[model samples]
Target: MAGTIQQIAELAGVSRGTVDRALNNRGRINPEVAKKIEQIADEIGYVPKHRKKADDTVKQAGRGKRIGVVTQLSQSSFMLQVNKGIRDASKKLADQGIEVLVKENASVDEAEQMQAITELEEEGIDALAVMPVDCDNVRVKLNELTEEKNIPVVTFNSDIVGTKRYCFVGLNNWQSGQTAAGLMGLMMRGKGKVLVITGYFSNSAGSRRVDGFVEELKKNFPEMDLVGVQSSFDHTDEVEKIIVNAMSAFPDLEGIFVASGGQAGVKKAFDKLDLHKRPYVIIYDLTPKNEKALLEGTVDFLIDQEGYDQGYRALSILSDMLRRGRTPEKEYMYTEINIKTKYNLN
Candidate 1:
């Protein structure tokens, strides 16, 4: 039996990523650690498999291939990191003779996404990566792209149900919500009125987080009263208004959770209110604005969904499929749910 990368990593007491880098000879690692990893692999009868060298495979398979990427909520702060990942991956793929076309949408509108897809299809895209709006039409479009058009599709950041997408690369939104609920529970001492703010109700990512938070709150923090759950549509003004109105409605709101974008609006709301004390706040993303809020003690916690990895991996997965015929090991490639605070901002 051949030893797996996970086994080697476990034996070396290192991360799987480090093991992969050491074995593949891609990326930097401590020389001593790399030596130890190699020794472990040799002792365990590990054999690396590759059809061709990485560069050769990319050059051969990517020569004439094109990939299309469509992302929603383009104006949000979180998207900066995601787009950076896309741009970096695009540069790498371009060097290998592949063209990556990107379409950014400011809102989660099905019609807009459909139009973007149509345009990309007209451009003869070989594969697609999208942060799809959770709607019946978008789901149908994804299915058509994969099944009828013979174009592989990878969904990222947000996903829709009942789609023939090859895979999804992003956070497990439900678990992220549960994490928020636990954090809020701990902050409020398991009892307080809390408000929930979401980016868009139509987005499965946000909705699932809200659902998970609600279920976890009910099960564990029963005394924590949920004042309301409002959608901000990823708009700062909308988020500000929602927070202000919720605060007015629940004067004793003890905690607030923002499950998606518009975190700047949270600080704006705090400033506008100008209260002696503010509600304990939890937000998603590690954008500059959110980091500032945490540093200033406006937010209690920030949950990062690894937006960069979501963008980079989605495109990379599609490229691998088109270039090397490699299917994703998992249908849902969930990124890590990292919790950040001022104490551990790094």
Candidate 2:
């Protein structure tokens, strides 16, 4: 039987990536480990799998080969940055003859997303990258696009669970939320009424973040009172109204966790209340609004999910999958979860 990289790695007790590097004569590896990997390959009569260079495939697929990217442009600055990342990557790949088409929607409407995706498919894109909406209809559409049409789909930023997309490229939203909660608890000294403002309840990412925040608060800060959870739908007005109502209802609220967009609106509401002592605020994303809020003392902490990397990697991974027949080792490729504070603005 011909030996695969995995087989060689197991016999030689090394990682598949190390074995690949040793066999391919690429990357740095210890001489002894490289020799052992080579010997194992020879002992097993290993036949190297024919790998078409991704660059060659991109070149051959040639001019007019297109990748479609769909995301919400008006939702927040974060989404806008994600869009920029996609465009940046597209520019990098343009010289290689691959064109990137972007479809932007102003809101998180499932119908709008579904329509955009369907239109992209109709436009004959070779592959797709999307910031998915968590809805049954949308998931079904993605599944059909991948399973039926054989067109690869990679999701970025927000992910839709139970989809046939190749992989999810984003942060572990639950962990990010937990980190936010911990920061809030620490800032409030572990005891206070807490209110959580979530983005879209239907989306798995938002729900997971809220769930993680609530769970961590309950487990670690039992004294902290969870006032309520409000879905903002990433709308500024909605976030403002919700924050005002929650503050009015819970005057003792000492901490506010903005789990998604609308930080500007939340800041406005906080300003309106004119509390002598404002609630400790923790927001997600390091957008212009959040950055200002952090610097000006409106927001205490910010959790950023490297939006640019998410977009770039999603497109890059899908391109590699189509060009080289490579599958991501894991279903989820999580970006780094970075915590930002006023002292460390960079």
Candidate 3:
């Protein structure tokens, strides 16, 4: 026997009205309670007629809506491309009566991100797109905004796991890490010392990349020595000391995989070493500094996880969701990961 809305409401300790509102995704109900009711419905296999009607209601009322995009946008050229993507999307959607408000933080600060989201919520944004930092507090805040405020969120660049974000727009970071490991192994002939420089450990993307790279090396290139891993926080100035220390400790270091920013500083450190055989350097992104390094033979390869597509598509997806109550067919829309070398610099 198929369960009714009454059954769902009773199981969730809510009223029939609440169950109807939640399952249909209509009306202003507590997001937690709504989530509970929906879960109960799914468990009991209860379907609502209002599902079709809700979409129509949203489509009719959703035009001329405003959206907010919050990101940890720094002065880095990579972030600049992402911002350009957002602006491009905004321009494309202007005729459709959709408005995008982009807000950026200068650094990867979770507190600042939370505050930005809070301000956007207060502004009554129809939806939100965020470059989330993987933190418990940020996830909680995101949940609160989604369930409590009924604003759908899509994460770009970085992700906050175990939350209700509609979807993630980025690369297959783990696979990308494995890709880098493969390149490192080939460049160093599967032997010699390697140093890994990572961004914020709290960033899900960076952590996943590191995990994949390390796991790949452990499985395939057991002979390769992983000399050390240092956190640079993706800042250029902070990376010099870490790189200098590694070079001092492992004078025979044959390669480096910078999983974040600060590649420019790493180059400076190499200049100081002046080794007859420079280490095989592999880094991420197509930033200007990285481009110069690749051309000059300072970096062997670059793993480019397209930033522009992430920013552009995140907003597009969020806008569709806001206007038509449409959910993405897939949970993660992964961008392409291109391996750029000097030969392909053109």
Candidate 4:
């Protein structure tokens, strides 16, 4: 026999009313609790008699509503997880008759993002989710979209200020930077030279992270000298070149902090140098490459920004707004700043 709602409620340890709300998507319930109830329902093969009908109604109501998404640095390794989240959410939204149009840019170019936004606007997008370039033009465009056109916007991964974005979904980059500094300080034992490598100066995410790391290093680890700070533009070759040059300039460098992509270059630099003792290195993202490096003892730490959640929740929030007039519970939906080491790799 198919499991009943009562059985599901009992299994989930929730009231029947709460189960009904979660399964039917009718009322406000904690997202975690709703997820738990849904998981239990799936496990028990419990299907509500009206579920198909309710889904069909949602699909019909979602028809003709479109959400536009724009992402920067699509080629970066970290973006793989983020893009996966976007694609997953897009499929779910598509099942409900909502369209998610995505435009991926290869670089953090403000003009390119503005052009993409213009194209999506021409396509009659009802809402927008973007990884905006931190520039005056992009900020102005976002403001226009939210205020003049009345199109709700959600910024993910990277954000811009001075705009009426519905909410932001990503890491607290500054705090992550501070975390990196603290880890490096521990590894370096308080006094040594450290090098900093960043993706791009114009990117707010990278810039803020660098700022936080520098501030924390100055505050908590004043004895440690910052040997060099360089931008790699998220290119492996550039990162390798920067590392090689910095190593040449400061052979006694005791630590390194990478606030953005192109971490593969760090390994390349080590291999090329064939140093008997490598510097204590901390990089961002838990991508396969970074994971491998951690396992192989190349990187000391990895700070993951929950890339998948950043992509998924940004679209999900917009979908709720378009479908059910739901507003985000918080103005800033920061993802967890997870620290990954070899021992805890899972």
Better of 1 and 2 by lDDT: 1
lDDT of each: 0.87, 0.80, 0.81, 0.88
lDDT of 2 by residue, 1-346 (tens): 6778899999999999999876553433554576688779878987444232434665675554679999864557788668766776676445445678889988778899999998998888989998888888998988998999888999888788788888888999989888988888888899889899888887677788998999999899999999889888878888889888988888888988888877788778977888888888888887887888888998888898888777767776765565557777788888888999999987
Model 1 CA lDDT for position 334: 88
- From the highest TM-score down, the ranking of the candidates is 4, 1, 2, 3
Q: Among all windows of ten consecutive residues in candidate 1, which has the lowest summed lDDT?
A: 47-56
- Per-model RMSD to reference: 6.5, 8.8, 13.1, 3.5
**Pick by TM-score: 1 or 4, better one:** 4
Candidate 3 residue pairs that clash: none
Candidate 3 residues 181-232, lDDT tens each?
A: 9999998899999999988887788888998899999999999999887889
Highest TM-score, which number?
Answer: 4
- Give the TM-score (vs. native) of candidate 4: 0.88
Which candidate number has the best lDDT? 4
Against the hidden true structure, what lDDT does model 2 obtain?
Answer: 0.80
| Model 3, C-alpha of 222: deviation from truth (Å) | 1.2
List where candidate 1 sits over 4 angstroms from the true fold.
1-63
Give each model's clash number. Answer: 0, 0, 0, 0
> TM-scores of the models, in the given order?
0.84, 0.81, 0.81, 0.88
1-346: candidate 4 lDDT, tens digit per residue: 7788899889989999999876654534555676688779878888764545536776676555799999999999999989988887776566555789999999999899999999999999999999999999999999999999989999998878889999989999889999999999999999999999999888999998999999999999999999878999999888889889899989998898999999999999999999989999999998999999999999999999988878878887897788778888888889889999999988
